[model samples]
Target: MVVIGAGAGIGLETARQVRAGGGQVILVGRNPERLEQAARDLEPIGTATFDATDTDRLQRFFQDLSAPVDHVMVTAGGPFYMPLANMDLAAARRAFDERLALTLGTALYSRDKVRAGGTLLFVGGTGGRRPGVGMAVMSAATAALPALVANLALEMAPVRVNLIAAGFVDTPLSASLLGDQLEARRAELRARLPIRRVVGPADVAALAVHIMCNDALTGATYDIDGGQQLLPH
Candidate 1:
């Protein structure tokens, strides 16, 4: 297995899960310090530090692989939401491009590097599925991924492709995104979400590992949002 963004949160937790399942992983991250810290805990087969969005680096990473891997889990990147009025078109384009490129590059390269029947699992979100004032661009991206995954799954053949769409996971990114309002958001989810609790990184990680190990699943968008999508906004 290879876990991109393995430094923290979903990626880190998924690495731990895979390790616990007796699988060897090559961890990738953009932050050297955090990646090194994560490596200390899992003792990954190898570790690479670079932004996954760089297709050149991504291809090189696959080319340099010591051997074929069983799974490639992409947990890099995060959501960007802003109303059209407030949006910076260039930045939005870059973010959207980076997201698509990372996933597409993963599928393109993994076709050769990932063994037959292996999974290319991507982490995305269900939050963007809901149309809201600040969600225009993200909604498009969200709608784009599953369709892309389905097509890639076919294009990639026995090498499966899938997306895990989560909502409001309790990750460092979420804390940073919410800042002072983090607790309130958590409380709201706990009260309103069908699961009656906050969804944490471990929850998403567990789902990711499941998708990776399950060969029957492919070209599907699995939602693991503590039923957050079921409630009214």
Candidate 2:
């Protein structure tokens, strides 16, 4: 299994779940220290250091693969929260790299690495399925990934490709974005969810592991969002 953007939250939890299920995990990320630390935490698993946005490095990383991998879990993207009017060019580039370009690059690279009957799971956003302001580029790019994943599912044939559209996940990534108001934001967001609770990384991880190991599920987008996407604003 190959986990892209493996860092401190969903990716790490997913790696644990996959390992528990007896899969040989390979973690990928741009941060050498963080990647190495995550690999150490995941222990005995493989690790690759490469920026998803760097096409050359991504290509080389894939080329260096010794054998075909079974599962490709792409948690490569992160949200870029900014009002369109206030957003700068650099911010826009970050959004593109994190969401759109990253997915395309990872998929293109994983095109060969994924084995027959294998699975490619992309983590998309709930905001994307149901759009909102202040999250413009993140939503758009995430929404686009599922369509691409579906097409890839067809083209890749027996290799399944799906997405886990998560919502309001309380993770390090979100904490960094939310800053001091993280808890407050989580409380407010949880109130709107049908489950009336903010989901943790483990919740999303469980669903991801299930989807990756399941054979019959392909081109499916699991709304693992505590049913918040179903509610109206």
Candidate 3:
């Protein structure tokens, strides 16, 4: 299995889960040191450092692989939270490229490299389905991912492409963004969400592993947001 965006979040946890399942993992990310640390903890097959948006690099990485992989999990996009009025065109364009375009590139480039019946899983955002204030662009990109993967599933047939739409996972990335407000946000989510707690990386990772192992699941977007979509804003 290859885990793209294998940093300190859902990507990292997914790598851990796959490793726990006795599967070899290859960690890919833009940060060399971070990828190295993540691979060290998981004892992955190896680690590769490169931006997901680089199609040439992604293709070469797969081509150079010694053997075909059974699954490719993408959790590559970063956080972008700003109202349309405050959004910078350059930033929005970059976000779209990173969040959506890169995902498409990875899927297309790895289509043949992935073994038949293998899985291509993407991580999307819950805000796509339930958009809130200051998340217009983010929501737009997130909303497009499921549709994109659905079509890919058809085009890629037996390859089994799917997406996991998550919400407010309590990851290191989120903590850094939230900073001192992390606990406040967690408390608020715990009170508001139907699950009464902020979703953790492990929660989403478990679901991702399930989707990879379950042959019957494909061309679908599974929501694992602790019922965040069920709450009233």
Top candidate when judged by TM-score against the true structure: 1
Model 2 steric clash pairs: none
Model 3: per-residue lDDT, tens digit, 119-159?
99998877755667777777788778888999999998799
The full ranking of all candidates by TM-score, starting with the best, is: 1, 3, 2
Our model 2 lands, by Cα RMSD against the true structure, at 2.0
RMSD of candidate 3 to the truth, in angstroms, is 1.4
lDDT tens string, model 1, 59-107?
9999999799999999999988888889899988998889899989998
- Model 2, stretches more than 4 Å misplaced? 89-94, 189-192
RMSD of each: 0.9, 2.0, 1.4
Q: Which stretches of candidate 1 lie over 4 Å from their true place?
A: none
Least well predicted 10-residue stretch by lDDT in candidate 3: 126-135
- TM-score for each candidate, following the candidate numbering: 0.98, 0.90, 0.94
Runs in model 3 lying further than 4 Å from the true structure? none
Q: What's the lDDT for residue 46 in model 3?
A: 82
